[model samples]
Structures are given as structure tokens and as C-alpha cells.
Target: MDLFNPYNLQVITFIVLNGILAISIYITLATGQLSLGHAGFMSIGAYVASILTKQADVPLIFALLLGGLIAGVIALLIGAPTLKLHGLYLAIATLGFGEVVRVIFLNMEITNGALGITGLKSIGSTLYDWLKVTGLTGDSFGLSVLQMKAVLTLLFLLLLFGLVLFLTLRLHRSRIGRAFEAIKADETAAKAMGLPVAYYKMLAFIIGAVLAGFCGGLFAHITTTITPDDFNYHKVVEILSFAVIGGSEIVWGPLFGAFILTTLPEVLRVLAEYKMIMYGAIMVLVMAFRPHGLIGTDTFAKLFDRRRKQAARQAEEGM
Candidate 1:
């Protein structure tokens, strides 16, 4: 394929998809709740989308949404009961849940078990066909549905980032943020403050899980392929890597982390094995050097305060 061919667009598309994955991980991590089972939600999204299309002849776009809905429902089922668990236990439960999803996929006949889903119609192309049904295929370029989806994915990622950021900022600044901070600092204290600790924790989980499901939908359509192995514990670790790297600055922290780590693997292709080694090293250094996290609010506040002081000094000097 040509270098500038549309195939390269997949890489761009995945960066955005993975960015969303990183964003989803960031939400729970911010609340001091570490969920290691993002992959289960993602797998649910992917499989549901594929199954709906393959079995009942569902349209691609609707199937993608259905996949996300399925993931959210599963998350609600898993998250609601488990919200009462502590950090370590919650992490374990999520990880175990992911493993169960993987195992179930491995044994399922319709999913083709370990062989995985294949020959599935690309959502992009499917959209093209559906669009043609409504007369929207276009006059020139004649772009296939996959290309259309890639374009839409890129645009959607930007929109999602904005929407997530806006909501997160609001959440961080609201009474909820203080509650989240209190809970993160001392759950007992938060409860003493009359906060509904369980409810908020569940809320954060639902938000993050829904977003994970959304990202999974993007991944489902973009890759148009998935396997049980794709949603394993290692994936949970990877998403955590993104959250850790992004810092805890409410929003941009995770976004920054996602962008850097998402592209890190490709950037260090030469190092190959050491690339992963170096990635770990970087994470260690970041955690050590900036333990609160790469973009934690504390670090951001310090910088903001410094700038404010500098601005005041400059204003006096000009006067």
C-alpha cells in the first residue's frame, strides 16, 4: 500500500480510540479507585457490535451504539455491587471480571471462541452502503464506508475530548470534586462529612465504564476485529499506564498521558523489546519524580500560582 494511503489513517484513528481508552481509565483513577477491567467493557462493546451485525443483520452504526450499551449494562451489573469494595479489592474484582469475559469469549461458539471474529463487515463500509440506501454516497472520491468512519472517528474523538473535559472540569469544581477528594483522602472522613460515598463511587464507575464502552465502540468499528486476548489484564495495566502518565489534573492530565503513551510504542519501534522496558522505566521515573501523578492537580496548581505571582510582579513593574 502507498505510504499516504488510507491505511495509515487507521493508525491515526487508533491513537484517538486509545486516547479515549486512556480518558476512561483516568476517571476512576482520579477518584482513587483503580479498575483493572476496562477490557471487559471494551470486549462487550466489540463483540456485541459484531454479533448484532452477523446474527440479526443489525446496521453498523446502531450495532456500535448497542455494543456500548451492552458494555455499560455489564459495568452497572459489575460495578454496582462492587462499589462497596476497597481499592485493592475493587481492582482485583475488575481484573477478575475481565478474565471471566475473556474466558467466556474463548468458550463461546458464536464468537468462534479463540479463533475470534472475522470477515465482519467494516462499519465504515457498512455506513457507506446504508448511506447509499439514503443517497449520501457522494459524487467524487467515492470514499468507502471505512474511510468515512475513519474521518468520523477523528472528528468524534475531538468532540469526545471536549465533552469529557467540560464535564470533568465541572465535576472537579463542584461539591462532588471535594467529595471525591475527601473520599480519596479519607473515605471515612468523607462519610463523616455526610457524603454519599457509595453513590459517588458508583457514579464515577458508571461514568468511566460508559466512556470505556464508548471507546470500545470506536475500537470495534475502527479495528473491525477483536479477540478475547485483546481485553485481558495486560490491557487494564496499559490503560492504567495512560492514567498514571496523564497525571490527575482533572482532565488534560489523562489526555496528555494518553497522547504520549499511545504514540510511544510506534516512536520506539527500533528499540522493540526495550521499548516496553523503557516505557516502564519512564513510568517509574514519573511516579518517583512526581508521585501525585504526571498531571496531578497539585502540580498544576503550583504552576498556576507561580504564573499568577509573576503576572502581578510584571504588572507592578510596568506601572
Candidate 2:
């Protein structure tokens, strides 16, 4: 199969981006804090990165980092007070914040008032040019310029996702991760045990914001155009579904969820207009059968253990 075909490349790119966004939400959910305003942080990052790259001619890497940093700062500021709220209240407050961000961008002249900034430089083209200048392109690669660009973009995104996944895995075993788990399991008990509940929650919130911001930057560069409408409440719901459907018990769950959800529609393309209806139904069925998600704690272990026991029993009976 031609994985680098434009259509396939676009689908893969979106899956990676959604995986990153899913991880961001999972980070907050790990701390038992449900934040529905990640789209707001993402918008902040997208606009910041887009402006810097388009106007100041900054490098893409630097622009993305700066965008994430700015998003983290905003998360820190708002998370201080809003983090105090729990459950549905927190979700409502965050949803409101996302609306406020969209309206602000819609009215802001710098954002071009809903017209949005277009013609942003494509990272694929930049990478292809760099490779060409470095004498790495041509017959040696056995690929056309377009194919090369698509491969480069995919590699870059995969590298970033791998880095994020590595850090998340390390975090899962870290002291801070344990604190987050404790808080999620029982906030009152965690506080009683002398853990800094508020601080950990804030830290998780900021980290999630930074991740979403980074995702926004990557998304903007890939699409080469971004508007306020790109980061709406619907976007938030989509992101949250990734974490929920994948299962919040482990970091891999959300990524897996993102992969399934992102590609399901494509797989159902034959269904045409009915694809989305099937997609929604599948999600509902999954939720009804596995509320903890497809990969809850010990899911794999139990499955493997059951298989091992069955094999042993069968062997004994045969003997």
C-alpha cells in the first residue's frame, strides 16, 4: 500500500495529532481533574505559533515550543482558581473559557477577525528543501519530492509522539505520577495523607495545556490554515472522547483510542453518509460494554492469565 499517498498521509497525520491531544486530556484525568477547555489552550498555541512563524519568520520548532509555553502560562493562571471546582462545575467553567477564547480570536484584528491566517509555511516543504540543499534528495532516496515531503512530515510527527510517549511512561513510574494516582483514587484521603493535592492537580493541568498547545502548533503547520472555529466545543468533545473511549487507566489507552476513532471513519468510508452514524453507535456500544474503556487496569494481565490457565488445564487433561 502507498502509505505516503496524500490521503493516507493526511489521515495518519491527524491520528498522531489526535493522539497527542488525547494524551493531554488523559494527563488531567489521571489527576482526577476533568478539563474541557483544552481547545482553548490549543487555540492559544495555534495562533501564537502561526503568528510567530508567519510574521517573524521564526523556525517551526521554536515557534511550537513558545506556543506551548504560552499555553502553559495561561493554564497556570486560570487553573489556580478553576481547579478548585470539581466534576460538572469544572467542566462547565472550562467550556466557558473555550468559548471566551474563540470569541476573543473572532474579534481580534491580529487574528484577522475570523478570516484567520493562511499561507503559513509548510514544515514538509521546509524539510524537503533542507534535505535537497544538503544533497540527500534525488536518485539515492528513490522517491519524488512530494513523497519525500510526506515521509519527512510523518517521521517528524512520529518522533514528537514517541518523545511524548516516552516522557509519559517515565512519569507513570515517577513520584509525581504516584501522587496523581493517589489523588485520582481518593482526593480526600490523599489530602489527609499529607500529599499536596492542589499543587499536583495544577501541575497536571499545566502539563496537559502545554501538550495541547504543542499539538495545536503541529496541526496548524500541517493544515497550513487555522481559524477560531477550528478550536470549538466540538473539538473539546472529540478530544475528551479519545481519553474516555480508550480508557484513562493507562497512557496507552488514550493513544489507542485516538488511533481507533481517528481511523474508524476512514475504514467505514464505504458506508458514505452512514459512516458517522455507525461511528457514533460503535462508541455507544463500547461505552455500554466497557465503561472503564478498552484497556482498564489489569485488562491484559487477566486475559493472558486466563489463557495460560486454560492451556495448563488442557495439557493436564490430555496427560
Each model's backbone clash number:
7, 0
lDDT at position 293, candidate 1: 63
224-273 in candidate 1: lDDT tens per residue? Answer: 67778888878877788777777754667777787788777777888977
**What tens digits encode model 2's per-residue C-alpha lDDT throughout 1-319?**
7875877887898898888888899999999888999999999999999999999989889999999999999999999889999999999999999999999999999999789989988878878878878889835678777777888888899999989988998998999999999999999999999999999999999999999999999989999999999999889988998888899989888988999989998999999999989998999999999998888778888999999999999999999
Q: What is the lDDT of residue 236 in candidate 2?
A: 93
Regions more than 4 Å wrong, model 2? none
Q: Which candidate ranks first by lDDT, i.e. highest?
A: 2
| Each prediction's whole-model lDDT (CA) | 0.76, 0.92
Q: Which stretches of candidate 1 lie over 4 Å from their true place?
A: 1-8, 127-149, 174-178, 270-274, 315-319
RMSD in angstroms, all models?
Answer: 3.3, 1.3
